[model samples]
Target: MQILTPFKTITVSLFVLFFLTACSNEEATEQTNNTPVAIESGDECHLCGMVIAEFPGPKGELFEGRKSHVRKFCSTRDLMSWYLQPENRPNTKEIYVHDMSRSDWNSPSDEHMINAREAWFVAGSSMKGAMGPTLASFAQKDAAEKFVTKHGGTVLEFKAITMEILNTGSAMNMGSMHH
Candidate 1:
């Protein structure tokens, strides 16, 4: 058997390295694709077609799959509505919502978006979102409790949110009744 010359050895090693790097980059790109995308000016709600940027309160972004385009929502309510559907639940890759504790209720910032699964939500607050009554998302439980004390909402975890709360419009009316 003939041994490879130094030049040939170098070329083969470089080719292998290049191929490995390309594979690694592709994986990184896939992961990055799941990261939250900032809502644009003209971005419309995936469910209602409302102009997302024009609305106040926390917004949502959903990554359905590794290659799917993010589904944007004007309010966290809309995001939950979509996610609660039987067909969408199994396919969900990622869900993001603004941390209202770190964002303005009237103009949520993209930099404050957090993993929705880990967020605390205040429902039935006095605050109105894109869809009228909306769930105010927070990153911490204490922040949620503080908001409830001030805004008149019940603090709930992600799984605690239900379709009944969304459909009845009671979340919007909850704290308002006391006043």
Candidate 2:
């Protein structure tokens, strides 16, 4: 019989482990792709940037994947508008635009607030010559009240700011997003 060296055994084990890990990852990814991911309450909508509330029952659109009006355009009309005029849409990836329930802009996840919109901003904050829309969103109401109080700005529902309004870089000037 041929003798196997310790180094060879360890190498074999490592290769098996690596192969198993890769397969597991692929399986998980495949399962995710098979089904539409439901947008959860805390997650920001792809279109409106509004945060879904835990008790915001029977409102907004609910697509097969739980898509909604404020979150994903609210309607086929909005979605088509977005697709046709891509430039008009805000950087859905960079900007979030959450409703503020409180003014702190500090601890956002507090339960005291019921439902508020917030804009989670990061990318456009540094854009030059007129920064793009910057935001973070929330589903807590009290949070919105508190946010406007300290930040000193108007509080608007998710529908207030449309893709057109946001594209002008106007909301960026709507007082402070500071908490």
Candidate 3:
């Protein structure tokens, strides 16, 4: 007589498949919920500029190096038009930003977060015009320090985009359409 183990084999395979699918789904959900979108440098902002945090796309970044300061932008048009200007530009090449993805408090960094070989910069604004709180970034600590020394600007980090910074002198001016 032969043993009937065909049913047992099929049951084992089904259980394995179900278990794998469940595990992968849980992992994906957890990752999505736990991280912010990645930010890039070159892409234009939804507002202003043609470089850095002002370049267009889903996300852009700005930095004023002296600290590890990094500012992530949301839209190209929103960022560039009001963000980038020679007067608004920080005077240092130490600032490094990306233009590949978007980021925020919810999605700060990612697995492939350090994409900087080809980076660009754009200016920034708190509101319509008339300037806002300017931040600086640096690649090396010493370089950033030198910049702060020469430019008289402040040093900052990537994790310091607080309401106080964004609200300085009403950076959010929703009144430019009448012009």
- What is the Å distance of residue 64 in model 1 from its true position? 0.6
Off by over 4 Å in 2: 1-133, 170-179
lDDT of 2 by residue, 88-151 (tens): 3443221122223332333232232222123221212222211223333335545544544554
Q: Which regions in candidate 3 have their CA more than 4 angstroms from the true location?
A: 1-9, 12-134, 169-179
Each model's TM-score?
Answer: 0.78, 0.28, 0.36
Clash counts per candidate, in order, are 1, 43, 50
Model 1: which ten-residue window has the lowest total lDDT? 167-176
Q: What CA RMSD would you report for each candidate?
A: 5.8, 14.7, 13.3
Q: Would you list the rank order by lDDT, best first?
A: 1, 3, 2
Candidate 3, which ten residues in sequence have the lowest lDDT sum? 121-130
Top candidate on lDDT is 1
TM-score of 2: 0.28
lDDT of 1 by residue, 6-41 (tens): 999999999999999999898788776477888999
- What is candidate 3's lDDT per residue for 1-179, written digit by digit as tens? 86649998899899999999998887665443112244454543334343434322223344433442445444322233223445535522222332223333123333323322232222232212112333322334454455455545343444343435444423433344334
After superposition, the stretches of candidate 1 with alpha carbons farther than 4 Å from their true spots are: 1-33, 170-179
Local distance difference test values of all predictions, in order:
0.90, 0.37, 0.38
Query: Pairs clashing in candidate 1?
Result: 124-171
